[model samples]
Target: MADRVASDHESITTVRATLARRGSTSRPAIELPDEQSSSSPDSASSRRDADAFPAGEVVRLVVDGSERHAKIEEYAGDRSIPGAYDAPSMARDPDSASNRLVEWADDKGLELGQSVLVDVIEEGFKYGVREPGERVFYDATEAPDDSLASIAQQLEDN
Candidate 1:
């Protein structure tokens, strides 16, 4: 446990030192763990995990179809996100707001083959990304006749 704590401390210190040393050409290279340590299996795993999400970054989910669109705003805190999406504009239409997603497999007459798209909402209270599968969008109607809803469910599971 102590060894692990020490490694964590060392990593933090190394990062801070590097950031502070940026733009200074006179300082020697700051090396915490050398190439051998960085290339180790554990170090590689740590790198992958570290790249998961950045703190305080925003993530928007846009589910769209013909003549309709739904968007939600959230912050990428630790993992994917830490809390629920706080979209105030689309809060009225619970059906169109949170439940509806793009029609990937079938249009089911709702989209009428117009197609659907989902993307990260770019600006606050504005339209977000429309590319499919970029974010999670699901429709839970218990019994939905719309083929698009079925495809959206599949997208969510995937």
Candidate 2:
């Protein structure tokens, strides 16, 4: 078996996720629920939000000053949970598909109603986690606009 490797990249965005306790013991300690006004027909049983968190992609989670790899997944869409869209959950591996946030939260002594910062490392692929606080931004170079301009400059000929 090969050991897991880490990737180098900057976070795209950080989300302040408020924690909520799950009703069932079988479920994770918290449910990072995302409720939308409408349903996404294109979304599948997993990777509900491909633009943000892609399933099977590894993410670096910084919990309690420690870093770990986690996979992003969305299970609500599969179960047909109403108003739930792109609700990402972390897993250690593909087989069990369990939420890693639960264990991390327990280790950090985090409770329900608290907020956690989930940083998007590579758009849909990678991400990171930390304590929620002020918003942080990464240094990035903006790509030049390629679209046509609405107003064209008039050319003068001799």
lDDT of each: 0.25, 0.40
Task: Give the total clashing residue pairs for model 2.
Answer: 0
Best by lDDT: 2
Q: All candidates: CA RMSD in angstroms?
A: 21.0, 16.2
Runs off by more than 4 Å, candidate 2: 1-12, 26-49, 78-100, 134-158
- Alpha-carbon error at 4 in model 2, in Å? 21
Q: For residue 31, what is the lDDT in candidate 2?
A: 34
lDDT of 2: 0.40
lDDT of 2 by residue, 1-158 (tens): 11222222222444445565454543333233364213211121112244565544444454444444455445654211111112222243234444456666676677767765555444543344555443333333222232421121111111
How high is each candidate's TM-score? Answer: 0.20, 0.45
